[model samples]
Target: MEEGRSSKGGVKKEYKGGITPFVVGVSIVAATGGLVFGYDNGIAGGVTSMDPFLRKFFRATYRKMHQEEARSSAYCKFNSQILTTFTSSLYIAGLIASMVASPLTRLYGRKPSILVGGLSVLVGAAINGGALNVGMLIAGRIMLGIGIGFADQAVPLYLSEMAPKQIRGALNMGFQLFVSVGGLSASLTNYGTDKIQNWGWRLSLALAAVPAGILTLGSLWLPETPNSLMETQGPEKARAMLQRIRGTLDVEEELSDMMEATKTSEMVKHPLYNMLQRKYRPQLVMAVAIPMFQQLTGINAIVFYAPVLFRTIGFQTNASLMSAVILGVVGLAATVVSMIAVDRYGRRLLFLQGGLQMFVCQVIVAIILATKFDSSGDGSISKGYAYLLLVMICIYVVGFAWSWGPLGWLVPSEIFSLEVRSIGQSIVVAVNLLFTFAIAQGFLAMLCHFKYGIFLFFAGWVFLMTLFVYLFLPETKNIGIEEMNSVWTEHWFWKRFVNQEFHIPIGIKTSSNT
Candidate 1:
């Protein structure tokens, strides 16, 4: 039962006992939290474009959508703030919930937070499916948002803590893989349900409960992570759980690391306030920056409005939804690729490559739109060019799904020391949901004004984020969660802010690298 511990040089021996059946099964179950998140993300865009959905809640927007407006105004057809509010409101609620869930997650174990989130989604789905008025709809959305915030805040941390050091990157990526799967499921549901006429949208919205329910029930049987047990229970219980999870009794070394981390965590009177110290500057910066950059990449803007975006670019109603389904498929496949390669190739390389790939795809899409559809041309794009646009969009989705989509959750979850890990993940979810709200709220409006230039706006952001990663982000591949500080301490720029002595107190031989 040899396991890799974080070393300065690199991982010594890979955990031969990593990827146990119990651990993999639990990781898969916990990853369903991402399914709820992705399903909701994919559902909003498709449902918004459904004729029945719009005619019921937003007749004016529906009327505008059907009218023979100017080609330039095509982007503005669905630009109603109130309509976008239905989608964006969830994110605003999620932002608040992520912040509120932080202390609760720390006080309790991660499993309770996940359970609460799932139940909220279940109730919210029921509300949404039965809603007859705008008020009911928004209220339901807020509940869903709360579910997402809590789930998003805790699941990554849960996965990170549960995963073995050698396979941590691959296991953490299970969250994003399920997210892509959930999005694809939503797209396929929307594509099929669109034909059911008046009540189809309800079915689409209601089906969110399936994943939520699974997560809720599955969480009941799941064991708390060894780290959580170490903190809340005791070292012996933590060791026992670790043995069970690892399928081995030779867990003394790993349990010792958890004990040391817990000791440091115990010293902190207030984890949130302690995060503001100079020693934690790098972790705090990453907690904020990574998720912030993830949203700014404009992936969510496209994902949340794919159906509307395709229709705006001249696809018919059915075609737009089908395009979204294709995007989801591509995203799901790319995530699988990421799961395989993240640990092998490392996060830094993928981040740079994915950023570059997305940047190129966006610029190409922008150029195609700029030249193909101008004032002189008819509002409609040529069928050939339309297919090309979809291809480019799919390529862009591939880049994002493989990179920022998963790593955004992964990096923040693994970076912080145990003392601030929960709070750090809360910040990650908060920043993610905040910008997600902004993008969902303003994307259509921005498209109305910036038109093709909006792609350029996102491309600019992609370039900056890629540069940020190249300069600041250290490779966290194969590192134990407790030894994360060593990665920062060895970095060129981050080392100045990281205090090795603070993270590894006197006589703690946690890492030979340090």
Candidate 2:
């Protein structure tokens, strides 16, 4: 028994290694894309105050009309749509651009692909900041979308590949953390400059370029992924990179294991084709389902329209922006909690707990709105119920941050094997971007048309998500990549409900043929 225990310890020692400084360095550099993603998403809300510049541009381009005529014109009402087009076109472009990530990552390697993404963002930011009209802004946003597409697809994958198995979830989730930070930064910047209308919005939009520049410069110093190095180069170069990354000279066994993993990954047939095949249908379902539910939770509606929602609940403009900042703070805090809890308590537990909490909060908010308990005369809302609505929004944000925000990215990368990971994750992100575009485009209209019914619609969806997660998601606490397929296929209930859960762990011995 002592000898058996000793053998187990030996095996564990082989699995464990020193921290990889290069990996840490590279992850920070790559995560700039996440910052760009967050900044672009959040900046538009604040930029809406640039009505003077927009009006000037509109007046300069078209025939002058009387003040009353301009006030009542269709362009006045649809000015927001023009801005939405500028902003949301990036997401649409991202959705289309993500389709290329699998091949791009394969051809260029993750690092170079990320560099190209950063450059695109920089160019987009410059164009957007210098835009003379809505058309130019839309063009810039399209370029930004291309950047986002590459970063969203590559950064998470790069993080997952470089991370140690034990801490992969936490490290991968760093993307979400940076996203929250970027959002918070944008909020604070906007709030600080709210009094200065001329340059505030442009500065807010351009600030995103700083991170992209830094990341682009920093990428030059980082090492490529060992897997990428091996696949593209040869064994010796791969071994050297592994040594530098792992800070260990004795990487013969580790190198062998990685080579075998890569070879097996290569032998697997066309991943995109396989993803659509029956054999991989379960994984494909999971990839699509998680992101679908993530967007359907209406987090974007709240984030994108927080100030509007707050004002609807009775807050003044200054107060509404302040409340939005508070909401962002709550979201950041909840994400920090998730970062700590995800690895400790595991992914499934958080999803179940967070989904249920979100459902309850949504129901409460919907009920309050539906009953007209807080409505003011003249189509305005009362301020008395602001605290109640704020509390509910905070609760919903917490629920989303702790579960869906990070896990939505983490799970898909883990669920698919390396063979199909690129395509699988791209599909997941594409669906996410698509739904994000759809929701962002239609959310205000839906709210305007359906009133409080929109909240109820989201509430119903949250409840459904809670049921799905409770019944289907699997526990993937400390599983290795090679074991994923067996774990997924063996458990009948897990296989059936895999779409509901984030990551389902499979236990398989690499040495066994079975």
Candidate 3:
């Protein structure tokens, strides 16, 4: 394998060749999971805001939305429990389903989990399109949630494993990029279908199946990741695949490291229990904190409720849907910026910069709304201020799309060794979905009570999470996936928790090993 030395004199493996087309194609196909995730996020708000959709299953909410006096309680008009539950149930079910995906991913391989997720989404979309009642709507959403849980849990791991260390961050971010594309697709679909007087929402929900079907079929052709192969199919097949993936015959050094890690992992029957060991404290903390903090950023709250938010601020239904389309477009573009820049500028810089940008935008938006818009008066925001609010929200989306949106999945997927990787990913998915459910369920109520102050509340979280990264997170650029243990052991703080004895046999010529 190619090699390099850190400033501290630790040896590191660096892949030397250019990334092959085979890997790129595989990574793109695997990232369809993000599309499914993005579509749901984008579709929910637009569908809910549609008059026909609201009239059919949420008549009370529809009437409240259309009433003259509804302006008096702008944020409270959409506060129906059933309505929010329709949106939140998928996340809760996803949270549960992710926990179930942990072992299955380890046993059957990443492709299977992705395929199952896609199939579940396919069925869920069909059910949702044909739903006859609220119960059927929720049931369909639950199936969709299960599908997302599985896909979200496995896709990041699959991408991380398959990508060469040189562009792992960029490749992994492809998942988030597709997520943006899916959201954009959903927003565009919602805009077009809103004109269909009676069943526009049905079409919006059904189109989710198109991407899900692609993922399901695409997964059938995916090569099992080398890391997964090593763990489950022995070293010979793992080496063969690694060589094929790398487009090189000189994969012995990397394959040897994979074999060593897999051999150690084989002795651990329960990765969940193993994760609780003191040595894994860093991984454990990150798996919980990263995903939890990602949700706390309040990006999802905006994505999930953008149409409602714009309408609450006095935009027309078509205007609200169109505004969501704007946010999706901006987000998709920003994610492309991240994909191109992440490896060059590094993850920590993006996180810090994006955090500062989002925090500033949120505070400014809150200030503008609090000072200029009279919440107690029965009037919509002025045209200039309405567009201004949309501008600030778009900036906020840019900040998140480039930073937390992708790194939350990338960092967690890369940190864990072969043994705990699957379970570690499960924790990430579960925590992310749990807080996502909480935000979807509570955001409307919080908006009603807190009003503009809700933005300030998220600003506080953004501050704390930024500080957490500045203090605790180590820069992981250029590190091989299997060699991540070195990063923790070298960090000034985390080193105390990492067992000095712990090492991956990657031919590192450290003085101690020598």
Candidate 4:
């Protein structure tokens, strides 16, 4: 059994209590990768419109002359395409990297994997800020994507393991909060430097390095997940790390739970491979499908293309940038609200309500766009409609922030057993990253080809997601990890999806009251 403490000096001491602060602090610090992820994505929304910077850095070239003028002008149609491609190709690379993250995490401990990812971001940020050409920028973006892949895979898993049962939902919501903060920071920075486009975009991109550096340096002092340590190292090492992380909590009980969950003692060769077998397929499906559905909602398209979409509604470039900033502010606010509400109301209810809300917003936006409410004689949209579009987009963002933005990470962690948690999360994130890549690559094409139909497509997805949440997802707030395995075992809807039949053992079912 792991070590425990006796009451001393009139204080009731627990084995895990002493280490809790360190665990929480380290987990939050390591999770800054989410911040870097958001910063890289958010910077482009405003930076794309920096005309002076573009003109200064990407000047017209005679070799690409059109009618005796340089055709490679930053505002030229081709240059716009180049910029869009540069902005999105990294997402594609990240999508591919996410697919491998599960296997990588299984092999390397989460802490080291995250450190490597953080270093990659630092490198990518430096390369991107100094890029002399579009090709180099694209390469830098790919590198950043690789870093995100690692963070995306590891951060949630680490948080799930470290957080106490009572606060897991709230703590996981921190990931979404950081993501919003990163977006807000980028928007504010871009807005502040709108007048100095030459240095503004570069500066914003480079700022991503600061968080990456902090996370890398801080992780050195952080303890690995006690579960990982126990399974990979021996119980003695795991106990020491747990004592450091949990402080005065009942370390023996926690260690016993970890041991019970570990598959290493059995004849099974690999825990992840064992999970992929017929027994755990249901958990696997929920894990992968939740994140896949999250991305299919087209959140990334809105995030990455917000400025462009607003521009289409007739706003001037600067106005659109400002509007995008407003959207970021609204998103941040809604996410904060979600962080508070998620633990109180539970994950399933919020998801159902949020999905339905997004559906309504998307449909309304589609209608407005389809009717061309403020288009000029030449079929170009006017600036007046930009305000309406921005409001609707904000509403849509609120819906997403309150639902999938947090629950996407929260639910998967809650649903899967500890044995498959890492691999399951990796797969879930991989699907999300893949769809994100698809949206990033095809958003402009869909916009140009079908015009308002893109919104309609997303609207349908939100509707489906709403239905899925109501049908399959269970409330997981305040539930212990060990108790979660039985939730699906007892529910009829979940039973149909789970491949292996199991009974909810006695003493496992607790009060459903929130």
Candidate 5:
């Protein structure tokens, strides 16, 4: 690598020391928590139409009802309500867990917080898999929610702190990509088990415990993040950990940057004040607004209730579960595209394009759902509209994965200043969980009343979010965490997103190759 001058009249210093395998390994291990998150969501979403699932909890009777009696239309509607409660129960516990994350992370450090979270997930799985009644199942789902709430915020925060500036976006996106893998695994697992007797859905729910166990065990052996180590053990220990993680002895430059950032460390103790300060107002706005819009896209409603959505669109029980598998694959592939593009094209471009694409998919689906099918007749969708619905749903997932999935996690983690970074993350994560719960729990009600209006509702949000990104959010490609404040302060709205031509170029200090 060599130094040079750019057309913008800035000096450039290149980096030759590459990232080591250990860093990559640790990043993957830390991100496996995301696998548990996805698996949990998929298992709940996929199990709704399983005969075993419906008969076991929804229609099981001490009143002498048999298999044929359990399939009654009245019984089916009641099952929908139970299934909705079962899935939403996880979120209630998750919302509670996320609200308390600041205290948990403060007392235990990142590693232990995640370890406990993983164990909680495994315990929840056991409870859910072995349940013999609806009450027990709801109890288990609540525990699962608590566990996912713990991992949801902690994993991304750890990844964002551990990764180098060169590949930070990729590593963070990897967290989300693995989430899709967990989803894919769940969908395949459900498809494999969909034909079994009453035990099939139980097996699907229990299978996720394997990944949670892996996450717990892997995190136990990993080192604490550099930022956490620096705060607790001082610079020498932090530097040693950084060298080991980065696989380089020449860490003086990054070390200096971290030291300056650490000066704001006091605010972590009193994060609420810092988060509300005048200086941080804009970043806080961006953090809250983006995640809010992300949920408003109805992505979680799709993730947690896709089988139900497809059921309305005319697919049979097992076929709807299989369709979810396809959606999961499409989502995984799109996330890979985001991992590649996030660093190169920047967050703003992806958001701008992804939002518009999602709106297009939603509008087409909405028009067909609104007019083409008779809601009062057979619940099965016509073949023409069903195929169209499937394709559009998959495309909507592509748009979501490329923009909201990774960016929602990455932006909130990166936008805040150091003082409130951790707590700001919890608040943002809590908001996401809260909205997810609201959307998931309330979606069935929305569908009953609004029909295609629900899709139109989400489409309108997409348009608003697209405008929000273009006007308010700045591109945060390779900027240092310490330098994010300057980006928000840029006066010209148009100048905020375009790179190189803008006033303060990304990668910070143009003389340095980060």
Candidate 6:
């Protein structure tokens, strides 16, 4: 086995590169987008819980109703629709921006795309924090969505290109790790400001600006991805960038691989048209499926309706809020674990591991809630059942954070080429938000009507997610971004994943053109 150690698989066996501090630093700066992403995610749900902001912007129904809906059915339905719109506005805007993200990234390059995202969030946070009415809040939500769209689309693409195969999985997940951190920060800030009355939620949301501003300014000094420079600029600039980012003069071999890949990438006569050809169809399907399943896993349903779920399971208002904050902490911890172990353990293993655990967790949660969380005739779930439900939900969050949360972003970026990278990401990420929007808009109704049945729905999705990964997606652990077409187009590719013992023949020719 002159191919080195035949004893192992993935990035470890293929790459012997050491981690560079400069690359790590740049990654940290770019990943601040995840922080803002997470912060906004947590903050939006929590803001409605703050009495002062809710009363002011939402016109005191939250206060008058005592955290419950109005007695009038018509008014309640109208109010619920409006409130749902406010929360989903960001995601709606995200869908709009995602449609155009590919072309924008192509035009501006990844760095500028990220800069636009950061500035958009900065403006959004300012508007929401100072809003006097629901209209202003919705407007701010749109900007936030647009901003996050830019960051989410570009950050993963940038990391996948800049990072070596050895650290690619781990480095790409850095965004997810920081997202958990940002979420945790929002939870803590909410807890800290819980007693500050009306303006507390405003202050909590405004804090998202801090990270946005930091990423926007810090990214100015980051080196553009060599892949991007190679395709758009030229070899000399690409080589210089490789030297700076990798901290090496010995980049000749690496440069050769990228150059060859870039040539193959530009072989396309028409970008979108060529991307839809038979050879590219499989990656396109996977690109769409990964993000869609990530949302369909019902994690957002849990997040958007946490208080209602907690209260339904018998938690007091204070206890429910506290539970959300604790869940945020647990999720952040799990994401950190993913960042450390992703490259070491390989992507598919973690994905399969998480799927198994999440499936089981959902089953248990459904059983517990179904059997134990009966209302006490006063609309409160029994205390014992509430506590039991809490434990199960924590376990559920752990499973998601470790797997889909990080990998959802990482996978799409890896599976596409430079030619369609931006647009491909735009399509998938937009689909992700669309799934998110559907869940956000419909979840409360699901909660009111289905109760424990909602967890069961998630459990069913876990089964499909697990099977999809196992049967369809191959182990792309150490595969270079440029070599992806070869992997997808290999003969008997389905068997490669199924048998696990079969390796592609060394001299086999790729039939991507066929």
Overall lDDT per candidate, in order of appearance: 0.89, 0.71, 0.90, 0.71, 0.77, 0.75
lDDT of 3 by residue, 120-235 (tens): 99999999999889999999999999999999999999999999988999999999999999999998999999999899899999988998998999999999999888877888
How far residue 106's Cα lies from its native spot in candidate 4, in Å, is: 2.8
Model 2 residue 196 distance off true place after TM-score fit, in angstroms: 1.0
Q: Write the per-residue lDDT of candidate 2 for residues 78-151, one digit (tens) a residue.
A: 23455456557888999988888778786567887788778888999898778877788788888889888888
- Estimate the lDDT of model 1: 0.89
| Candidate 3 off by > 4 Å | 1-9, 15-17, 509-514
**TM-score of every candidate:** 0.96, 0.87, 0.97, 0.86, 0.89, 0.89
Model 5 has a clash total of 2
Off by over 4 Å in 1: 1-17, 69-72, 374-378, 503-514
> Tens digits of per-residue lDDT for model 4 on 28-139?
7866767877888788766765665456444442122122244222122222455567678777777667666766665567887788778888998998888777777788
Query: Over the stretch 201-309, how does candidate 5's per-residue lDDT look in tens digits?
Result: 8899888798899999998987888777766667888788789877888876566556656665743567776677655667677767877888999898888778767
Task: State the RMSD for candidate 1.
Answer: 2.7
For candidate 5, list the clashing residue pairs, or say none.
Answer: 314-380, 314-381
Which pairs of residues have clashing backbones in candidate 6?
52-198, 102-423
Off by over 4 Å in 6: 1-17, 59-79, 267-270, 375-378, 490-514
lDDT of 1 at 180: 95
Cand. 2 Cα-lDDT: 0.71
Highest lDDT against the true fold, candidate: 3
Task: Select the stronger candidate by lDDT from 1 and 6.
Answer: 1
State the lDDT at 333 in candidate 1: 95
Which has the greatest TM-score? 3
* CA displacement after TM-score superposition, residue 90 of candidate 2 (Å): 1.1
Residue 418 deviation, candidate 5, in Å? 2.0
